[model samples]
Target: MTTWDLAVVGCGPAGSATAMGALRVDPTLRVVLLDRAEFPRDKACGDGIAPQVVDLLEDAGVRGVVDGHVPVPRLRLDRGAFGVDRTMARPAWVIPRTVFDQRLVEAAQAAGATLRRHRVRELAQPSSVVLDGEVEARTVVGADGAYSTVRRALGLMPGPMAVALRGYAPTPANRANAQVIAFGTAGQPAYAWSFDRGDGLANVGYGELLGHRHDRPTKAQLRERLDVLLPGASDGGTGWKGHQLPLSSGRWRPPTGRILLAGDAAGLVNPMTGEGIYYAVATGFAAGRAAAEALIAGAPASAGARYARATRRLLAGHLRHVAAAAGLSRHHRVIDAGLRASAADQRVFDDLVELGLARGRITPTMARGLARELAGAARRRPVRRRR
Candidate 1:
């Protein structure tokens, strides 16, 4: 058995990003990347690559892959009765996961991390993982996704999970540059989205929070809603694929010991926007740096604590707001009012967009909007002074 310095399980964005970050910190470190599937695998996602993802790719030296992707400079928020198109401060990209993930894997291999195609069966302590056999390592980073084998083997219970259904549709020539996010309507407790893929195609999807008041939509129901929202968008020939999104609602506990967890394995998805790519890359970077420093200090056991603290510092405030917003989402009327306000006020719309991106902290603009809404509601209340 060839002992390695570090072993990263799962070679998706999180895994590849971890390997790349770790190797960048220490070129001499021996790193092995493992995954069950081969390269160019397709993932069920809306494929909305946010600006933060582009930033991470650039930092990882993989910006070349995004060169030909469609640039989405604007986003339309639709709430049935009202809709508004707001220009994004930083443009996003619409790239299929098959292309995006493969590029990350190649970038990791280019950074000198060895890539191996093998299914991980179990994980053990003392920095050892069992695939075909027991492979010993000084440290292990689990970047596997929501239903991670590492997380399950380690007995880490996740928080609320969201289910999403998505598929590709032929894009209309006139709407090739359009990106739309539509809120749920007619008793549906989810949201739908469409992103133009820059190749006469669009990725359409819908997601709902499980265990909510309403039942999860069926595949046929999801397609039906997509057809209604995005007229003439879906081909109605291909089937929609569903995936689980593990949301971090500030209740998830981090793994302890020489082993560390990152990305969806750690339940780092945003509770509000269902955005995991940014958290995946961010946590991967943090885990890699922490693991490297711990190894260099000859205290591999401290890696978990370091990673936990770093991730909390990076995600605590953001997740706090996400949890609050998710709570507000439970009230349909509140969301409707907020959407109306956002559509009418550009300042409110920009603030909401910023909040969705997690780029800014709570600001006065948000507070003012809430206050105005409350004041208007008070004025609309009927008086009972005669009694």
Candidate 2:
């Protein structure tokens, strides 16, 4: 019966970041974070934390999120015989979600948001948002990740899904400070990553987009794909886990009610790279800020639309651009050409990183470069990589 200003489900990065964003704005707004699990819990993820996430955390008043983690400054993209090794525009930290999520939750609590270890089984909004008929809030943020329960309550289906298997192992000697990506053959559903966590371990995984004319792979098949794509990397790996990512597409529209979806719940994962942390933090923060403003204005129901506009302005045509890029990448030789172009130019590589990890769009310069590389790549045979 007691209503709070904001209630966020799922106290992961997205939910905690939402609380931080709201409290950072007003600090007095009654915000509650509800989650099914306790702190220091494991999450299935590639565990690559982009510097852009650091920026968002800083804005949310949570610093040192990845402070002690090792940073990977270089990115290497490879395909059957074509490859590119380039320095990232900024370094990325590889921190397992267990540490990262807990820190964010603690930061949110420190910012005056209440944390409750309660699982939100159902959500209903007649006038005010209610969770399981126990928790009530003027506005709700569904940061519950892929296959979100709150999202289902909003009468929406999740977008396309990509499944990946992740585990950690001793860092390969040859890739000490680099995040390596092995692209699947063009037009095929295959890609694998080995990101150094800078602690002698590398987070390794393989994934593919689903519902784009491909069947979802089983766990055994996912591990098999990892073996084929990044051989010898998965050996002796520990704590192997599989999770689904809801890929972002331009088709996403905001809810028409007081509920706003953020993070994986909104399908904000980068279609091109399966990256969601950045989008999760950014959108969650945006939603929290928008919800705070709406509550302050005595129009909490307007939070969804306000959050939508805020994301549109924040993402700035990136959603459409990445959707198109992912489409083009399905064609033969597109990945090869992209790697070739990125290898030849730093600007292109930087652009690629921005597109995958943050809100970056296709650029004219990148287009010209890709076209040139495509033309050149056609004349040569792809070099086969050693398993």
Candidate 3:
């Protein structure tokens, strides 16, 4: 039983990022990276990296991997009678998870973290993780996504979860490089997307509130809608995959235990956008920093609590706004009106950016302006027309 200083379960962006962060913070620290699957494994995702995530990775020295992929620019938002193409001046990258996850793991390995491809069976307190009949590590990190084993071991399961379906399609030569979000295609409250990855291929998928199924299309059915939406890229067959996202921030209580959680294991994904890569990587970096501080300086083991507090400071307002935006989208009419309004003016895009900066969520300030406009319209309601 070679007791290690830290054992990280799951080698996705979150796990690898955390390992890299911890090692960078302390090169001498012994960190073991473990994943149930082998390298180049696939995870269901839209595969589009927003600009914010790109910046974070660059600061973390992983920008090369992100830059190597194709750049995506505009995000086309749509609903039944509403459609808008919002320009993203900052480039977005589209990369296959198989390549991206492996690259991150390799980077972590280069940073002095040992890598292991063993399935983690169980996790125990007071420094121990059971993987392949062996108990290893003085500390364990749960980066294993929504159905997180580390979280389970620590009695920190997510109370609410979201189900998502994703896949890839062939991109036509004529189509523009853009990320498309279509709502009300098959029903209300559910939406599908098509992301041009710039390799004569695109990523297409759909997600809906769990248990809120209507006459909407299933993951497979969305393929037909994809064909209707983008005829040029619809000739190829469909590829379908599914995954789960946890909504709650998981348990941050007693953050000073022998086992810690980060990324999806901690339910750190954005509640509205279904975006988790940046948040996961960010959380991973923070967790690694906290772990390193605990190990090198023998600081109060409550470093994870500090990390959680920092996460809230950085993301709570944005997440709350996400929740509010998601609520608004639940209404088909609102979705239609929002998209239609955005298409009419680039100001909508500017407002969205400002709102995200102001409150942390991707909200369009145009909505508030539109409300004011409506109020003004009511004020001039022909005062002499009293019947």
Candidate 4:
């Protein structure tokens, strides 16, 4: 019958960060972190950790979490005969989720949050937030990823999804020490990537948006496409696993109660590049802070409103811009234009990375570089707005 200040479901990046954020706000507040699985468990992901994610973890008081992992400074994008290879402004690390998630959970525990091994089957707000009628808290943050129980409990509509298959293999010599994305011919927004882990191996994967004509790639076909896209890249690969990405195609408005959703549960994955760690940590922290503020103000039911406002300020505009970008990306020529532009100007490359990785909006420079191609890419007449 112990009531807690906050209960966070899911001990992945988002959940751990949520606990850390709440504890940072008021170290004395009681926070419980729960996950169905144990630490060091493998998750099916590209495992590309943006440096921006590291910055956020540092803010959450976990520094050097990616220590000893090699920094991958170069990113390459290719489709058909067009390609762009360049060094990014900031380096990124490729660490398997097995190591990464465990470290974040440890940091949260170190920051005075309790970690529990329990599956949360139900949530109720009849009084304080209650999980499975046993664990009670003033507020709850849901960070349980794409197949989110909290989102289902709240009766929220699931967002758009992209499925990706991931595996580990020895780094191909030509693509070693780099992160390479090869746009697939099967469909728009489909690509295969090989990211060097700096230990003679690379994390390789292929992903494509669902609800498209090319959505139905069987497991063997997915692997076949990977082999064709990057020859020799998948050689001697192991542990191939696939997962769904809940894309942040639109804004997520939390209900007016003590429950809030973060990370993939909120559909916070980046639409342009399928990156979610940054969004996960950022929204998790915001949700945690919002819950903390509501709890401290003695208006726990207001947690959702506080979270909605915070995320609106943080993601609304960015989501809109990325939506526009994603629409244009439906055509392959647009992808070619982006690659060509990035090759010609380092500023364009930096801008594209920023837009894909962090809370970056489309810039005039980006628009100027790709606008004409975009118009011609579709080869369609513009619709005039009604007067």
Task: Say which candidate scores most in TM-score.
Answer: 2
Tens digits of per-residue lDDT, candidate 1, 263-357, equal 88989877767878887888888888788878888887888888888877877777777677767766766666667667667777777766676
- Candidate 2 local Cα displacement, residue 189, angstroms: 2.7
Runs in model 1 deviating more than 4 A are 126-132, 173-175, 186-188, 212-217, 228-232, 236-239, 377-387
lDDT of 2 by residue, 166-249 (tens): 989888887789999998874465699999988888999899876554566788888878878788888889889999998888
What lDDT is obtained when candidate 4 is compared to the true structure? Answer: 0.88
Stretches of model 4 off by over 4 angstroms after superposition:
212-216, 372-387
Q: In model 1, what lDDT does residue 43 have?
A: 85
Provide the lowest-lDDT 10-residue window in model 3. 354-363
lDDT, residue 56, candidate 2: 78
Q: What is the lDDT of residue 145 in candidate 3?
A: 90
Best-matching candidate per lDDT: 4
Count of clashing residue pairs in every prediction = 0, 1, 1, 0
Q: What's every prediction's RMSD, in angstroms?
A: 2.7, 3.8, 4.1, 4.0
| lDDT over C-alpha atoms for residue 262 of model 3 | 82
Candidate 4's residue-wise lDDT over 1-387, tens digit each?
A: 668999999999999999998889889999999899978799999899998899888876798789879899999999877799999999999999999999999999999999989999998777787889889998998899999999899998777888888999999788988999999765556889999999999999888888764646777777888888888778899999988998987555666788999999988888889999999999999999999999889999898899889889998999899878888887777788888888878888899998899888899998888876565556765678998
Count backbone overlaps in model 1. Answer: 0
Q: Residue 270 of candidate 4: its Cα lDDT? A: 88
Q: List runs of model 3 lying over 4 Å from the truth.
A: 127-133, 173-175, 185-188, 212-235, 248-256, 344-347, 350-359, 362-367, 370-387
User: All candidates' lDDT scores?
Assistant: 0.77, 0.87, 0.70, 0.88
Inter-residue clash pairs, candidate 4: none
